[model samples]
Target: MEYNLEVAELEKKYSNFHLKHINIKLPKGKIIGLVGENGSGKTTTIKSILNLIKYDKGNIKIFGKNTNNLTKIDREKIGVVLDDSFFAPILNVNDINKLMKKFYHNWNEKYYFEKVKKFNIPTNKPLKEFSSGMKMKIKVLCALAHEPKLLILDEPTNGLDPIFRYEIVDLFADFVSNKENSILMTTHITSDLEHLVDEVIFILQGNIILDIAKNKIDNEYGIIEILPENISKIKKEDYLKCLKYKNIYYILVDSRLEFQKKYPKLEIRKPTLEEIMLILVKGE
Candidate 1:
């Protein structure tokens, strides 16, 4: 099997916080969503893959080769939008175009110009003068101009208007349409990714809680509601987690068949990703 990126037992410690052993495999040509609460090591994982942060254990591979062995050509194939302030405040979008052209041999000027125009970003204005959403658009255009095979985005959706955020997410869908390009986007906007993400990787407190396809999650996990009468009779282990809101109980179960066997009269409903994450983090 071929993978675009893989991290096995990668560990990083910063003062009091520690990113425990992380094992992740990103297959080629897929959009994988990295979902987590604030300060959950999403950026740390992205940095580990890019070799921006030092790790104490295990190995990280890009394109099947260890990150330590990554060549210049390998670096050229991976693009990154790490943060909102990567570019100098004085540099404008036009200035960035000139800068990126020199950095990547495969840079496409036409593509860069087109994206800038499509996003309606003012090229001559200083980056600091532009709004947060405009700056993010410029960063994304810079990454995409070089025709990179993989995009590692760290919280690219932060502080953007709803319209632009949706546009940016749609742009990601267009990015992976070639089937040769892949994206590992770390974001808190799970609703924006509802239909766009191919795989969802849930990270909590530096540990991966779930790694599976979006369709599988929608089809497999369910929110089961048992009436006051049937709640006591239901097997506790069969339900993975549960919550109590007001006077009703909202239960999570992995398999509907198993849940139904025990509580045939119970009503089960499809749970959203946000709902699942809430139940995982906050128990009944």
Candidate 2:
């Protein structure tokens, strides 16, 4: 399968923090969710890929071209949306549209304004006066107007209302429908991507702890609730991770189908994205 983005042996260090050998693959036509705590290397890894920051080692390739060698066309095909945009605070939405049009060869001026109007964004006011939600909407409008082949987003829906959130998710699904586009996003709201994401990459304390396919997440892994005493009967190898709450123990099992055969008395159910993160992050 062709990959939209690839990272290998990526490394960076700071006085108190280090991101080591971070490797990632974003397959074309899929949405890959980057999951981790606030201080984890999600942003750091993304920054290194975008060359927004200098990395000590490794390489990033977007559209099969090394980031360092990205041509104007290649760069233009990749869209980026960050939580806090670096656009001049004095610039209004109209100014932003004009500026981006100069750089984006595929910029659709009509589509851009249509999106702005659809989202009910004010066109005349300076960006500095807009709320966080409004700012993010403008970023989305810009990213989608150019019809980018790949989207790299950081909390693109951070402050959007539920209706807009659903709209954005559906838009992502539609973008990849052409089977030539993909998305890599880091978000605190895992539930939003529970149904939309094709892959999940879990980073912890600057290290990638889990990278699992979305289908495997749904059909294989599960939350197993059983008495702590029954835990020993379940093979030690079967436990991916486990946590205790009150009298019940939540076990993240490698395969729910197999576990059910071994312990029919236990209760096994599908785990949400948040529950999986909790067990993997905090459980023993």
- Give Cα distance to truth, residue 152, candidate 2, Å: 0.5
Cα lDDT tens digits for candidate 1, 139-218: 88877889899889988877788988889888889888987788888888788678788888888888888887888877
Candidates' lDDT values, in order? 0.83, 0.88
lDDT winner = 2
Roughly what TM-score does model 2 have, to 2 decimal places? 0.95
Would you list the clashing residue pairs of candidate 1?
none
What lDDT, from 0 to 1, does candidate 2 have? 0.88
lDDT of 1: 0.83
| Per-residue lDDT of candidate 2, residues 1-284 (tens digit) | 99999999898998888998788898888999999878889889889988999999998999999999998889888889888656988999999999988989899999999888988999999989988888888888888889799999988889988898998888888989898899999987898889899999888888889999989999998888888787777776777898887878889986989888877887888888888888889898
